[model samples]
Target: MGQASFACDPAQTRGRRVAEEESAFRSCFQRDRDRIIHSSAFRRLKHKTQVFVEHEGDFYRTRLTHSIEVAQVARTISGALGLNTDLTEAVALAHDLGHTPFGHTGEDALNALMQPYGGFDHNAQTVRIVTELEKHYADFDGLNLTWDTLEGIAKHNGPVGDPVPYALAAYNALHDLELHSHAGAEAQVAALSDDVAYTNHDLHDGLRAGLFTEDQIAALPIIGAAYGEVDARYPGLEPYRRRHEALRRVFGAMVADLIDTSRDALAGSGCAGAQAIRDLGRPVIAFSDRLRGDLKEIRAFLFQRMYRAPSVMAQREKVTKVVEDLFPLYMSDPGLLPGRWQRDVAQAATDAALARFVADYIAGMTDRFALQEHARLTGTHVLGDLT
Candidate 1:
């Protein structure tokens, strides 16, 4: 299929923060994707948590695996809808770059701790990572990605306004991302792909962890229908195989629905260009109302069964304390930070600035590194056997 009328055209990208010569072999979006893949922040994701902690199990998803899955799903959907697959893949791969060590639990703890210091938002942190954190470039502080790539990453979730996170606001002051308007259709597709990947994989993970059984999941709406079909087609299939078959069906259904729904929305909107889709003030990529309702039911089940289950909650408490302890300790004694980070700490003129630097340092840590650092500092193991 040809590129969609509303697909982001690489030739027309808004360009990078620090101007540089164009690549001889790669399009702007491809260059952005390559840069993200090679970034130090991206490498740290292997040790970051998705739902379960990194040490919980070898089979459980880590941020690195989850991002790869999201990229695969996004590429499939973007290809089906004739969207810009390169841009969509870039957004999907980079979306969670700023997620804390212990999944959402660590993020919540950090946000609570940073409430007075402008608060923590992963999306904003992601913006900060690409704009200022990755320091390999001699010319620029961050990756110096194209404006289109940056806009997609920053606004992939939708329009952001009022009380913007400090990192994003500061960057926007220098290079505006048009925070009040929607991102391109490719970015919208990447955002939805994240939901698709996490929902399906979490269900698989929950079942694998034995927090919830196939019988329990079979009671949900769309997933139930999928299980029913699986059982009917392959009676007496092994339990593990049965679960895989049912969940794969659920995943396929979601991706298919998203493609069809997005195609219809694009057709109805008459968006002849990528910017027109953004100016429409609504996402052109989304699941249908029926699938959205079904997903809501599934999310509720996951929230109650897997996320809130006692074992997971216990782990959350442990990691929360690790972040909570590390933040104030570093704030008071910035000398504890690594030598490079200590230089920034020394440069911090005010307590608030020092606190933010500490936040950045802690946020960048992997789960095991955070635990090790906490143990080193406090002379106690926070994670116990999990470490």
Candidate 2:
């Protein structure tokens, strides 16, 4: 199928941060996707948590699996909307690169610790990872990704404005990402696709973890309707099959709604080019208002039942202390950092700069790594001795 006139055309990308020869066969966006997949930051996501601590159990979703699911959803939505699937996949895969090890809990701890050091924002950290942290290239420090990919990741939620995260603002000064404007249509599709993947998977993971039961979820809005339909068709189905069948239907409904709503928005906007979609001042990709309302109820239920459950909170308290203790220790003596990271610490000229470097070192750790390092330094195990 032909692309929409407003789709992000790979041939027309704004080019990489450090200019280089274009690929012989692959498109710019495809190269960005490949680079992200091969990055160490992306690999670390394997041991990063989505909801539960990484060591809690292998059954729960980790950031790596979550990113793959987001990419799958984004590609489907982008293909349906005639957007650039490669660019959408690139954004989806790289969106969570800067997330700390213990999920949002680790991020919250780091953000609080760094409050005096310009604070921690994962979106900004992602920009830093692509633009400054990764050092694989011969000529450049970070992966020299195209402007489109960078912008999409930076503004994954929306446009950046005043009070921007220090990392993002610093990079933006050198190479402007049009921080005040919306990202391309492909990026918008990727952003909404993240919402869809996380919302549905959290429910699935929650059920699998026994935080809530199928019967309880069967009373929620969209989920309830899905379970009702499944029961009517496959009466007295096996519990495992019934749960999978119902959740898959809920997932399908969300995807279909997103595609339909996006198509309507695109047709009504009369955008003639990719830039026109960005200039429209509102996202063209989104869930319908009714679905959005239903999702809110589902999220509220998850928040109370799964995220805030006593078991999870206990793990959260442990991991929070791991981050809290590690930051101060590394800051007080940069020599404590591993050999590779110590080089950067040695080159720091000011206390604040040193703190930032330490923050970056801590932020890049996997959940297991953080706990291990904390135990090594303090002789106190956060998650107990690893088997």
Candidate 3:
């Protein structure tokens, strides 16, 4: 029998066996772990933002660091709970593959530009990246990732609608929808792990940025208690080393608490095995009452000090303006798009196809590429060689 700790039914891969020649130390999940490590999207993370831009400070967190933290937290919790560490690490690593250059600001801009089209969502875009965008095999267009990984990416947020029917469903009745929605527990864990990673690490980054001080952070009881716990556990490390390790420990505690709380809550509710139980729709964090209260305070701290800080807000507004102005220009002059886009626009196909193509062209851009495109189309700013 297949390993049963994780959620995705192993049968779904249709016995498409992982080759035996692959590393003996690697389980199916480990193979997936390696696949994600080798992806180009994974590398682009170094250039992406977490909270502060990478160029802003030497100590600031970038998207790459953020992913590493998420993987670290997820692996810890999965190891504790006897879940598949490799799978959790893979999911966390690939989670933000679709995030744009300027962090959420960039994503927001793209979403507005593509709103008339199928609307932009980083999570949804991540699915597209693995399934269609990352051109690898000549026979298969994208990374031929297992359905488990796709499910984790697609339904990580919990249940939305019915699982889309898969191929050959009910004798062609479900032909149009070739894949089932992957609203499973593993997916939910991936989503929750992302929350755990950011909520804690963002605070750490803010502190590093001098946007908030440790005393300010310690004002929140949950964080304060978590910090104390770490200090008590690791008493002999150097002061600087202790503080850094303490932050990671705090993140771990939060994740562990949330996972335990969530698992118990779901189990007690008689919804343990039901697919819908895992897809919580909104950003649900399974924490205790006290922890929940403290986390809100933490979020408030970020909103006031980090997200709404004058420097960050100024950049956010600039991104909004660039995206807003440039989108109309592209729509008006479809010729400005790449040759493939030009032909598609000329054909005037169904709106869905048109929208998908527009999204594709827009989503594939690097930060500098988007900026240059904005400048070229709107003539508001001059282009530079330094992307």
- What ordering of candidates by lDDT runs from best to worst? 1, 2, 3
Q: Which ten residues in a row have the lowest lDDT in candidate 2?
A: 337-346
Better of 1 and 3 by TM-score: 1
Instruction: Candidate 1: list runs displaced more than 4 Å.
Output: 385-387
Q: What TM-score fits each model?
A: 0.98, 0.98, 0.77
Q: Candidate 2's error at 66, in angstroms? A: 0.3
Give candidate 2 regions above 4 Å deviation: none
lDDT of 3: 0.64
lDDT of 2 at 248: 96
lDDT of 3 by residue, 268-348 (tens): 545433244344333332577877777788788788999999978876787667667666666666677887557657776
lDDT of 1 by residue, 48-115 (tens): 98889877788999999999999999999999999899999999999999998999999999999988
Looking at model 2, residue 309 earns an lDDT score of 95
Alpha carbon lDDT at 239, candidate 3 = 62
> Is candidate 1 or 2 superior in lDDT?
1
TM-score of 1: 0.98
Greater lDDT among 2 and 3 belongs to 2
- In model 1, residue pairs whose N, Cα or C atoms come closer than 3 Å (at least 3 residues apart or on different chains), thus clashing, are none
Span of ten consecutive residues with least summed lDDT in model 1: 378-387
Residue 372 of candidate 2: its Cα lDDT?
Answer: 89
> How would you encode candidate 2's per-residue C-alpha lDDT over 32-79 as one tens digit per residue?
999999999999999998999888889988999999999999999999
